[model samples]
Target chain A: MEEKEIISIWFIIGCLLFLFGVIIFAANVLDYYVPWSGTVTVLHEYRAGIWWGAFLIVIGLVYSIAFNPWKKTKEAA
Target chain B: MLGLIVPQLAMLFTGSNIISLGWVDSAIVILYFIFVLGIGFYLMKFTKTGEDFFMAGRSMTMWIAGLSFVAANLGSLELMGWAAASYQYGILATHWYWIGAVPAMLFLGLIMMPFYYISKTHSVPGYLKLRFGDGASMVSAVSFGFMTVLMSGINMYSMAIVMKVVLGWDIHFSIWVSSITVMLYVVLGGLLSAILNEVLQFMLIWLGALLIPILGMIEAGGWEKMVDRIHQNFPQGDYTHLWSTLGSFQDNPMGIHWTGIVFGLGFCISFAYWTTDFLVVQRVLTAKDLRAAKMAPIIGASFKMFVPLIVILPGLLGLAVIPGLVGETEAIATGGHSYNEVLPLMMARYLGPGLLGLGITALIAGFMSGMAGNVSAFATVWTYDIYRPIHRMFAKTDGTDAHFVKIGRWTTIIGVFVSIGTAYLVQQFASIMDYVQALFSFFVAPLFGTVILGMLWKRATKAGGYYGLLAGTVSSIGMWLWVKMDPTALKIIALSPYAKDMAENMYRALWSWSICVAVTVIVSLMTKAKPDSELDGLVRSCTVLPSEGHLPFYQRPVFFASIVFAVFLALNIIFW
Candidate 1:
């Protein structure tokens, strides 16, 4: 494919992902609530710790891959 | 034990007064300064040429470029500004992150990366000159310079306010302290020092920013208690519905009145930071090759996507915990206007001694990193674009390049002082965010018009470029004035309450940006293009070279990881 075509495809995919992400986030905001105890609950409050750990793991994976492109390229070469 | 011990530790470490601050805070502050200065000093070894000073000899690795891009763009203003917005606007402000930044960043990374890849110039203005002619380049360069100076002033002013209020230092004294330290390093080390210092500052800011939310969550009786408190305290609509509660489309903080937010996120913020800002562009320019520069912004933009968590989340958590805690009366009364204080207030309330001091130190580091970046960019531009041109024109009879470099160093010192002075003066007018935004909004549209259109539109001519800029500026200013002077006109224009303050003053500055592009295009269409020979170098910069065999296999994996991030962000918004 031509470079312009690749860029246009990526742009469309990115916009779709972003729009869908927002819709999902907005829906989550609407559903946030407390259990039967008649209190309020925050999504991040309960899940922050878990999310933090997961985020770090994901970051680590991305970091490793981005920094070690040479290994894959070497094999390709 | 967890709650009581943490508070006690915070009190011991991050006491209100400078002297009362713990040894660790003092130690970190002192050590960070020394480390930054040491980096600046070390970079002297590499500063043998003007290219090294301005662009690090154009040989930086992708990693270094990527980190510096994030560091330069993130700055202290972003740290405090986003936090404050979140504090005031509730969870809706997270729109900037979840809705605004993530998509824009990905667009920049995936779609626009190729453009930057092809554009092989050192400055964005150079690209405009390549695509159009000298006139377009000159206008862009000047507007960009003006915006940088204005932004620098805002960043310095905001930092000064924090230091003065939080540390009880005098404002003038804080300005001098911050300005001198940043100026000294930037003037000596130039781009090299700025990048190295930014890397260190980024690490500090990341740790410092994270500590506030984590510790605050623990203090508010863990996540469970925090949520309970928020629901109990705030009314139903405030915390839950992100966009609806902020009032009319005009008065609403989340309203579409600030189309600039879209323009900012989509075009100006990414394009300017990635393409224009020398502090950032210098990093990309320093890349080992074209591929590295192309990849660096993607990395940087990805890093930017995560910033809402670090900066904006704390503000959101603050809202969730203490709705209306920062009373609007106090927010407006003390020129402390806006929710900028959210992070600082949270720090004061939650973080204990050792961590608090470390956090404050990090805050200072963030401010200094931004200030240093601005000073370095200003100095480079003054020396290269302005002074160098004049010197070549006149001093060809006798003056030396070494003399110009010496003058550039002096210009940097003078520029920092001027920026600090501007910061002090600008504070008297408006909120930090408003002032910075207004200042940038004026220049961004015009500059973007010239660069984007000049490159993309083959029919664009020199006469069209000049006329387009003129029309954009005039129309925006005219609309702004109508909004300001005529109260009845406010209804017609749909002015926001925040914008109503300096009616004549506000709209002129605010709307000028949107008009710039249309004006530029219309004017360009009316004129004929110059010969292709004249446009040779202009378009060449936008040409992408064949990628060297440096394609990292890991990028494919990382691309998937970014997708996962998008999914996670989606889940957070949907479930909340």
Candidate 2:
């Protein structure tokens, strides 16, 4: 019931998303240089992988960092 | 016509070399649906009151609210609409993303958010009731509730039509399936489920759609090569230049005068929609504090500028990669696609099946996200603004929290059915999304004019508010009919021969906004203004943003606003 616990759950989900993104990024980078016949790469070379990977990591961090409700309080707010 | 198009579309999907969704694609879509349903069902326990159902318990973080804010606008129409716009109007469509949005979003955070947050209002109509009194709230409530449902229906119809055309899915099946799925989450989990799913959809759309422009560049050799190909084939240098085409309506593909694009769209329509439309502002309202509320749009704006990369660039790339689809007529009759189909056609050519499924799912999710936002907002406004007032008046007592929550749920069901009816109505239009946007323009331009006056100038009276909204809506509708009845009226009324159809929506907003402002000011001057004491924290003079001065430099809205504004200017300059 605690908010942080819920945030932690979301943070973990974000981590999983980041993990999937990294795998896709690694595959795209590797497959660009060396072909993998059996591997199915979704959304191949048509993205900014560096930005995309960084975005996923950043979102993971945000879910971890931004979900804290008690870290700072504003009485007027 | 159904018999003809259905078989033809099936063959077109097969023989046109368009990539079809395979088993992996189907699984991706099905899994996403199930995942969202689970999120909805699990969140149901959290919704026990109207506030919880409607405002996500007002506990949303900035990014959650921010992503939902942007994602709400990223509806099926936005993904496909801008693509279609770009396919027809060229890079000029980027103005809608940047000039038409960024500054206005910044304005909402920087100027208007303090009043909204400080007032502690639940919805935009709730704010109106606080500022202008009960009558203004009722007018706003009625119009906003109607607009929300109509917009939702537009999204539903658009999703259905796309599925029917591209995947050969039944229109009724698309409508029923998506509607039931959206209803499950939104009706059960309320705003929390909707916002959370929207965040999920936002990620999917970016991850899936970023492929089109990226792979598209690779297909055309590079970004430079794509530009060269566009110029080589179309030979209109203005196609790539944003400001260049604004010299004259006759000179541009959009046939819209610069005044219309810059002032009418960039100022009037964009400001109204960003600042006032409940569908978008509702997301920002769900944030926990003024800091989160103020930061939401700024955060949304940061991600928003990159949107053209996915939507507009795909349309530009389509010019190079997909040949022989020029006008809508040509696209539909011969190419077996429409200008709106540009996004999908490019995706089909570029993405393999698994990724293709994800891409398609993203588009479908966008529609569902949009529909959920509208239906939920409609439910909230209906329960709080419209039905609550009427029920209170008739019953002579306020209902219990549980009773209101029950009414909210039932209202959501009715709202969805109304949207279904409106969705069917969309089938009758040539450009359904355009009609929807135009209808939105009619409502918002006037609403913004009234809201801005009420917030900034305390002299705006209760009588002034209601009449101004009424006059503005009526004038815009009359102007629209005038132009519709006589095409030459554009030159007569708008004072430019260039305004017609889509371009007319922009200027029509300007005219109605002018009407709202003029009527409200004149009526307020004549009638007695509301006492400033009664207007306490609702007006600009009395209101103060909570986290305005105390926040660290990096966390400040002004800081983010400055960055977004700088980038917006840089983009305009670079594109110029």
Candidate 3:
């Protein structure tokens, strides 16, 4: 009998983080040019969105790849 | 009148929403909802058996179980309440997390896990059934089942209020959306799904909340400077000192003495909650092996030690950044910021749109997971301890495991609706909410007395256990009513006229616990003890604990617990 594959929770977290990171990072980039009217935080000059977004992207990619069910299935095959 | 104009003034200052989510932020929240449901659906295929539904098939890794254990306790209400407490009472609030929690968590890991694991009980009530018999178990199961659902309802209502206050969402919208989301996932996947999402929520909470402290520290210069700044704000206040101000009730903002801090909180309430609360212990029971089960809470304790950084530090930071935040009553009456708003206000001050959404999503996740934890535990206790036993009582034949699993699914659905009904009840009568919360302390402290005695003392009779529990619960409620009826009664129960509400709670728990132990001892001595043969795996004197000597010293639970304890001590001293 063939072994059934299970989707990893880590992969889901990674994918979600990656998507959120890209959007947040993109928002930061757009705001740099547009100067949006949203409530700018006290430490806006630090660009936390850019740094935090990049951090999430890196973590997300690492986890998504490491725990990817499709990759494990291919290896087993 | 001030009330009439206060509404207009509040709206003027607060604007439409404290936070306005961008498209990106909304997308992230939507994605979170989708992913949780996806995990639940994905796990449904593996959740066919009764064990799978109730215990996650006893297959969780230590990391997953540990994180889930802690995450289940880290409800948004706790996060916000403690943050408010840190502001109101200063760093003394850290005691609740450290000395109050860490020791109890370690005790559960080092001493208690052996019996729980070896006995193969599905719930804490189930453990009682093995040791004391049906009477004690039924009392525990019914109270736990009742309280868990009420707490879930309270959590649901709290989340709705937070959403309304923070983002201007409708209370109905928040309640229905989040409750249904929790219901769908739990009904689909059971404990495994809950554990998975709890781990995810823990991560999200960290990611979402970690920034405030990091950014706050930078803004406040450093810990030393932050302390100095706090001292400058309230020069006479002992805001930064943990143990120094704990000498007397009059000495500290919390109005608590060291004895109360140590004996009342550190020993009684902490042990009762961490060791016996099925909501958290259910997570540990998910561990794959005895070693994993034992190690789970130690890992949880290590993480729990750092929670004050996110929970307490923000309130401390608020003291430095936004002074003059009033109490809840004044905030409502005068259209001012309250201590409870410290976290949200700080988030608004630091996080812009994208990060703001993440923080909101984290809060929502905490609330939803809390609901899931309660409902899932309720389902387990209801099925194994209540429904099954009752079914066995009436029927001649035993039902199949599949029958119980089917019942568990239906119970989850029913539990959510009951919680929803209770949430509406709380909305109608807010004072009932306070009494319902008090119900927890009433049962937990006394029940802990019964369970611990039953586990440790071979002479603890079944009648002794039941009566002790009943007496403790009644005495706790009697004490609560005494304090409620006459405000002066607090002086007698708490042992100090200057003792604050928190201190009264601690001392009440202490008295009730003491009463429970004394009653149990007297009753057990008076009654016939269970035979040694009957005490086998249930009592510590009878049970043979599994040896971990074959494993390396570093891999032992004691090794990690010692390191965690060392860190806990260092933290207390540093903050002291």
Candidate 4:
């Protein structure tokens, strides 16, 4: 595969991760007001939900990374 | 008259007599000052150029920048202010943290990152100059400098009064202590010492602030008990629900109708602080590269999301336990009670001696750190943007760059005195929050007008930039004055007031910012651009550098954690 194509694929994956994380976060907020008869503990719920959202955002940023031309161009032999 | 004497009489009643006048607290404050001074003195060797003074030589790593960003933004204001809001407004006040600030930080990360990548300049104003022209840049830089000075003054004043109240020292003496400590460090080291001290101060503040809610929860028989207590004492509508007790469109405290709160708090306040404030921008500009700067605000935002757990929750708990503590209204009704004292009062009443002393010390550290951050940023702007320009324009051949650096140090000393003076003058204001917001609104709206338009609009001319800024400033001030003085406007302003003499100041600010943005855009479109030759170096800053492309990917763990945070926010907003 071409380098640009690989970069584009990574970018798309990163975006998907971010969007999914946001949706999960929005769902958690809905849980607070909706009176859902869930058996989940508050501490466990907060930890699991918040940490998961944060994890996805981090993944999104990581996956989107491409080689910077400025530093690399300077280092070329 | 009521404002002046009421506070003094209240101080007489609640003021700490056991702490003694400037003995233990004084020593702690002085030692902390000396430690900061040592950091500043150490950093002086590194202050060799304009970039070093303004942006810490642009060499700060992501972690240090991230931590310091949180520390600087948190300050005593966040500690005291969030707690006070929670004490009065209930969990709804947490909206400022969760909905307002966090999203703004993320938006800044996603959308504004491209600008940071393009504008490699040390100051936001410099970036504006590159994007628009000299006129826009100068107006922004000047207004920002003015706003910084105003805010620093208010912060110093509030900190001094808190120390005076908590430590039983004279207000004048408290001011002197606060001023000297901050000045000693900031004047010497500039941005480097400020960031370093902020990192340390953040730890102290977190430790101090976090203990309050945890201890309060335990004392009130844990979270369930605390909630029960709140439900019992407060009306059914006021207890757990976020929006139930909040002042409606017709009854806001600061003239902010419900819609105003939605826009002003949700958009204007967040945008102005995160996007336009030089102190925040300075941190971003000092990052090692574009990617670090872009990521830094997100980290700060993530931290902001959790801040309510430490700062705001304790205040709500304090409200639940302390009967009749119905927000700042009841607190202020009992003559001489300041909203700033809510957290301190809770500490004194609930916490035991050892922990109480430690907590008070932590609060002091938070206040000083904030003051230090302000002074350091003020010094950098004064030196780089103002004094250096005058020196070059006037002295030319006589003054070398080193001479200007020395002048910068002197300017910091002057800044300290000015801030102290402003603090004393600001005492007559209604509330700390009102005074700070009003001051910021006056300066920030106009500057935001110029910078935002300049960056986004290619047709934005120097003439248009100047006119737009003037129009925005004039209209905002006029609107503010009308709300204050004009009977018709006052009635509109008073629509939100719950009781007589209760002012809701938010309306003026909300309207003012809206007017500013509108005027800037309209005026910029009508004006002619400056010559391309004159705009060359200025616009170059907005051109994305090749180095930006080399940025590395985020770590997998961090990516995963961010996803979790988003889920938490969404669930809380939807269900709670």
Candidate 5:
């Protein structure tokens, strides 16, 4: 029987975080060009979306690449 | 916390929806659901054997098991409810995270994990059957199965209500969508699927709620300024101190004293829930080896100690920024904010579109993971403990492992339906939700007594274990009834007229646990002792535990646990 390798949860979390960071960071950039309406929370002026998004992207990329199943499989081969 | 009361109470304070998600936010949530279901589908092929289906083939690393162990307990209701509790009771609520959890988790890792790991039992009930006779195991299996199903339902109902109140989503839509999502994933990949999702949920919970404390601190200036502002808002309240206000019932907002906090919550309820409750224990049991199994809960405790940062900080921020939040009935009568709305209100205050979506998704993830944890655990206990025993007794033959695996998968489906049915039942009679939470304590506290005695004392007879569990459960239920019928029973049970409902719970657990220990000891003394030879691998004295002495001191479970315990002590002292 062939040995099966399960994908690491870190990889999944990383992918999602990276994707969300892009979307959020892009949304904030767009908001600068065209101001959005409705309740803009306290400290919105600080642009938390951009910074938090970048933070997620960096951590997410680290986890994703570090635990990627294919990389482990290649190393083993 | 049983993860039901505050949400059930929040059901009363209905008004206009607090926050609406933008298109970007809704997309983030949708993406989360896709990923979880995708993981479940991907893992299906690997889940062939009964062991794979039920215990993830016991191949999980310490980190996976550890995170899942803690995440299973981090339900949306716990997040929202405890955050609300921080607002209602002040910093005293952090006790549930600190003293109430850390010690018990460390004790499990250091003392109890050895017995549980070496015994090779699939469930906690399986361990009981090995040590005590069939009767004790049957009682535990039934009570656990019953409560697990009820808890899943309560989680479903609580999420639905929170969604309706917060985002104007349909109640049935929230319940069905979340339940079906959980059921499909659990049914497809079994415990493996559930554990994976739990790990994912844990990460999402941190990332989602992380912004709250960050933005909250920024808004309030800093920790010191936040404390100063909180004091300015409520001059008489002791909202920042952890232990100082606990000296007298009248001194704290919680109306609880040091004894109740120390003996009742820190010892009795914490030990029972962390050590004996199979929901969390099952996660640890999935560790790949004895070392990993022993280390899992210690890792869990390290992460668990910081949970109050997200849960309690929002509540404190609510006090500083949005004061005048009243109790449930008062909020309903006066059309004001209730304590349960603290987390949602904070999200509304701090989170914008893209971030708002992540916050909402985290809440949904918390709810779904809780349901998955309950449903998966129910399937395991029901198949291994309840159904298989009956099958063997009647048929006089042990079933195939494949048959058991099939039974487990089918039971997962059935359990979800039963939980959904329970959700509607609870919606109709809301008070039933409160009892369901109380009912959990009834089983856990007593079961802890039975399991502790069975593992430590060689002379504890099967009959003694059975009767002690029965007596303790009955006494706990009796105490609950006594208080429900006459509210003044708090004075008798808690030992003070000033003691509140929270204090009553702690003291009741302490009394019930004491009764259980006393009964088990007396009964064991009278009954015939099982020989030492028959108690191998089950009791401490008879069991020759594997030595970790050859391993380096730094790699030992004790070394890590000690560091975690020191941190636990420091946090308590710093917050004191």
Candidate 6:
């Protein structure tokens, strides 16, 4: 695979992982404030949800557009 | 909190609603599995060689290798074992985090990396083959190969037990799902996929576990209020102090003297694990350069210093918040769930459904990473050290490099299936599991003793290495059996009312290591030593010393190790 292609694939995977974290975090927010009495446990108030979600999103963004990782691979090549 | 009064049990993960995950929670977990599997499949395009299969072709950056190194060490034991231990023993458990790990890790990074890196061996046993000879190599390899598979199986059983008790997931379901998932990634991308996934899991563990200490402090009003509550509750119990209670075995709840903690654990067990264990060292060996290899453990050590905060605090919080949690009647009635369930309980109470699902997935991720670490390491050791020799001596013609990779994958299949069987058998003969683990601990101290002498002393011989390891392992087992046979001996040793099981373990490691060193020195003097020219890069005087002297102050390992050591001292003094 080309170096460029590998970077792009990492970016897409990172984005998807970030999306998963975001969805989990959003579900928590809905549960916390929506006053829904559904038998589901929603961590709307949990700090870990937001922290992990934000961290994944940043990691995604870094992989998606960061020139540094690409440069490192180039150097190795 | 609508979850407040819906009680079957009011603690975290105390729900009876098995298989009732919300749509988002279900989707999140499904995506995690798919994404991980996808990485494995995708990376298979690149994994065509033995180098790729075993060591990721030694191209990993520090962040990738370092995170994987630490995450692989964080197993179900990290989640449940230490958490429960902290709940039972209090803050003194932090010793395992700091003095037990940091110094040993730094020693590996600073002193040991050049030899391991410069020799260019695929596994620790391969290094043994290079340094000692085929005899020592085969001994270490066979033992490591068998032990890893058993450890993987135990990892599976541990995960199953947690899921069964907490989420009511059946043991078979846990076993199959975990085994298949672990096998998929490992067989697909080999070491790289396993490691990348470990990095992800490491992040998840912190996200999942950090909440207990953070929120527990809030609930107890603050650290001071929490300490006050603990004092009021267990006034006679020395649970808050770290070293202050360690003046004597009778004085400490741990039934260990300060000397035992420092030497037996911090020196013997720590050195044996960090320096000799292939599971952890393999990650560093995959780094792109020598500097990255050295830096990997430093990064791991920095992160390790904070682990006790996540693992130990929840147990301490349990004392102040959870009613009758420490009582044995409650402990047994709940299926040993009181203390063991502390981390999950804290998660359930604090996290809602989405976060709860993620937390549980994080735990499963931790277990799978451990299983993957064991399986992958076992595959390498089996193929290179065990299978190759047997094939060469028997009917095997010379195989190509690809043939070895194929053998490795076959070993992975065999190893995983074997682990599944072992996991089931472990369920029946739980007592055997203790002996298997004891056997592993038996190897560590003696192995370290041999490795250290070989690296530093030019006169160490191959015969000495094998014989020393044999003697050390035998003595360790003999002492362990003696202690198990006579529990009264601990009382006589310490004259303490506390159970001296852990103390006995530490002292045994010290004794075993001492015996190994003594036997090796005596044996080496009697045997023919290898020529120094033959020991190039495997011994201190023969290898090029790392150029840390020319590097900037912050980049040097000594500078970082010193900082970590200083923090370690301050933490001990503060908690003293």
For DockQ, the strongest prediction is: 5
Tens digits of lDDT, candidate 4, A1-77:
01111122224334544553454444444455663424243233333334444565576556444422322322110
> Candidate 1 — what's its lDDT?
0.57
* Model 2 error, position B394 (Å): 1.6
Candidate 6 lDDT, B1-576, residue by residue in tens? 011111112232343533345677667777778877887887788788898899988887776777788888877657767777787788988898888999998899888877898899888998889888898888889889999898788778777776776677777998998899989899988887788778777766776667667778888888788888988888888789998878876776777889888998999999899899999999889988998888888888888888888788888887787635653346445744456567777776666556666767777878978888998999999998888878888856766889899999989989999999988887777655667777788888888998888888888898898899889989888877776788666554334436466777787888899999999899999999988789989999776675667889987767877898898889888888
TM-score of every prediction relative to native: 0.75, 0.89, 0.96, 0.76, 0.97, 0.91
Q: What are the per-residue Cα lDDT tens digits for candidate 1 across B267-376?
A: 45435344445656656666666566666766666666667777877877787665654443554454332344567666655543334555686788888877777777
- Mark the regions of model 3 whose C-alpha exceeds 4 Å error after superposition: A1-4, A71-77, B1-16
Residue-level lDDT of model 2, residues B95-128, one tens digit each, is 8889889989989988898888778788999999
Residue-wise C-alpha lDDT for candidate 3, range A1-77, written one tens digit per residue: 02145566777888888888887788877777786746679899999988998898999999888878877733210
- lDDT score of residue B55 within candidate 4: 67
Residue B273 lDDT (model 5) = 93
Predictions' DockQ, in order: 0.03, 0.13, 0.44, 0.02, 0.50, 0.34
Please give the CA lDDT of all the candidate structures: 0.57, 0.78, 0.86, 0.60, 0.88, 0.77
For residue B517, model 3's alpha carbon misses the true position, in angstroms, by 0.9
User: Per DockQ, what order, best first?
Assistant: 5, 3, 6, 2, 1, 4
Model 5 has an lDDT value of 0.88
Candidate 2 chain B: worst 10 consecutive residues by lDDT? B1-10
- What's the iRMSD of model 2? 6.0
After superposition, which runs of candidate 5 have C-alpha atoms over 4 Å from their true positions?
A1-4, A73-77, B1-15
Ten contiguous residues with the weakest lDDT in model 1 chain B: B1-10
DockQ of 6: 0.34
Off by over 4 Å in 1: A1-77, B1-20, B75-77, B106-120, B219-228, B240-279, B331-340, B396-404, B424-437, B494-514, B531-544, B547-576
